[model samples]
Target: MPSLPPLLAKPVDLAPLWLVERLARLILSSVLKAHPDLFERLGDYRQTRYRFSPADLPLHFIVVPETRQLTVSRGHPPVADAAMTGPLVLLLGLLEGRCDADALFFSRDLSVTGDMEAMLALRNALDDSAIDLPSTLGTLAGPFSALVAGAARSIRSRALAERHATWN
Candidate 1:
């Protein structure tokens, strides 16, 4: 999958941290609301701190499931029990179970560090979630949901086309 061009990502790097964090939290809250059980599978691992670092981006995202909290960081990403570093697209695909976590890790397209057990637990939870990211994001558009979804799906297809086809 293609990474966001450095030029395109520059604005995000320059944006205020609070703004980015707020937007991310909004999306996270929406997803949580849509699938309340999304993290239930994690059970005991739900309290673990996870960091998602997009290799193409300048900052990383921190998520605390038990607290239902999300934060963004530029210089400091905060402590995490586990961290996954990869392109934003691949990460999002994994969240929706549209990407095979094992394949990505084995192929070196993704990297996981810190607590392997916690990372695997998170993967298992995601695999069982049956999440549809475009649909979830589209709902944020309200009346334009269908249009937004179509565009998102189109973009997603394009992003996944050059790489693996298996949506594991």
Candidate 2:
């Protein structure tokens, strides 16, 4: 996805839920391919379901690692064994290797609830998984988009930091 300069000074629309899920699935697929024995260590967890929603943005996703499947939740019964909340961009940033997942958890930037075991399992698995993303889109719009996205992220982080400081 290419990001443009914030010329209008309005909220930048997030990529569709499906798009996010697709990217996540692609990253997970790569991990599973590289680590074929990961499931064997995970045991019989194919039935477990986990729901995810961004705390700082509006996006919801349900991921089941055992099956390597993920679905965009449609406001159904929130039936999940565990739930994780955080900024959508930050979560993506972690998967993209732009931020550290452990630091986010330790700093209270992300929150988890529901089945503690399941949450721990996910945290451990993802923290161990090797997921990488290229910030450049690999086309003519790549550099410009990357620059704009980087600038936007800087603004967001500063704003969040200021809010936290004032609240404290």
Candidate 3:
């Protein structure tokens, strides 16, 4: 149920879409590079268009697993085979398999639409990947990888634990 604080969301909302998307692409690319077979686990669902809509952010992240393509936009995105909508933190938690997606869904904390099978496949894939986002992201820091990862991890822990109580 944790969400991005308004203060942090404001700057991101006001920031140029291209810049935000560039950063997003960097993150996705890093993950793809580290886990080349990420989508392969999806099987037939690999070709599905997945829309990850952050309920707390004014953006939609569309990912085509088969092509390993990701697109971030404020405007409308292409039709998706499935879509998941939730707070940014929740979405990130799902991405890292840090949250119990089924529990969240049944609790009405997460909203999933369209191809259920495909979505489930995507979730299974993600869970099996054992993705460590902070570590993967830290690799972007080069010589400062460890320090950056620690900071990111601390921030992530605080952000998820505090929910709307603090700005991370």
Candidate 4:
């Protein structure tokens, strides 16, 4: 059998908006559940929406840490909170907790704007719970290894489905 590529490892290419939205939602859902209090800090943003866009080689995540919550369509500045310029694969690696968040910044593999305060809130909220890939994999896996396999299949499926859909 051919070896599987690293999870989320990728070359530069335009991503399907739906897939990107899905991934962002998944991450936020997990984050919110883990750190409900984190959202509370956003004075009025308890019900705000945010967007992530990858411009250039790095992924730019723009968001307001406060409660006013800025989104792609309704934000004033309409710029990213912090620009994370680096390998997309590495960002995925970091997200999987395969790499330490601090270390990534130190190594310059990732960057952030609201990271200082935003990360503090994130860490405070999610420092305890970790992603239990074993369970996630058991719930959604084929014959291949769980983590990488499941994720790859999920991404591929979403990509194909999105491609087949007619926007009209």
**Candidate 2 on 77-166: residue-level lDDT in tens?**
367888777776555554444455556667777777788676665555555555433322212235586775566556545544543421
Q: Lowest-lDDT window of 10 residues in candidate 2? A: 1-10
Per-residue error (Å), model 3, residue 68: 0.9
- lDDT per residue as tens, model 1, 7-93: 557888788989888878878888888779877778888898999999888788988888887888987667898999988878888
Best by TM-score: 1
Compared to the true structure, candidate 3 yields what TM-score? Answer: 0.89
What clash pairs does model 1 have? none
Q: Residue 97 error for model 1, in Å? A: 0.7
lDDT of 2: 0.56
Per-candidate TM-scores read 0.91, 0.57, 0.89, 0.45
Cα error, candidate 3, residue 62 (Å): 0.4
TM-score of 1: 0.91
Deviating ranges (above 4 Å) for candidate 4: 1-15, 26-78, 133-168
- Backbone clashes under 3 angstroms, per model: 0, 0, 0, 5
Count clashing pairs, candidate 2.
0
* Whole-model lDDT per candidate: 0.83, 0.56, 0.84, 0.42
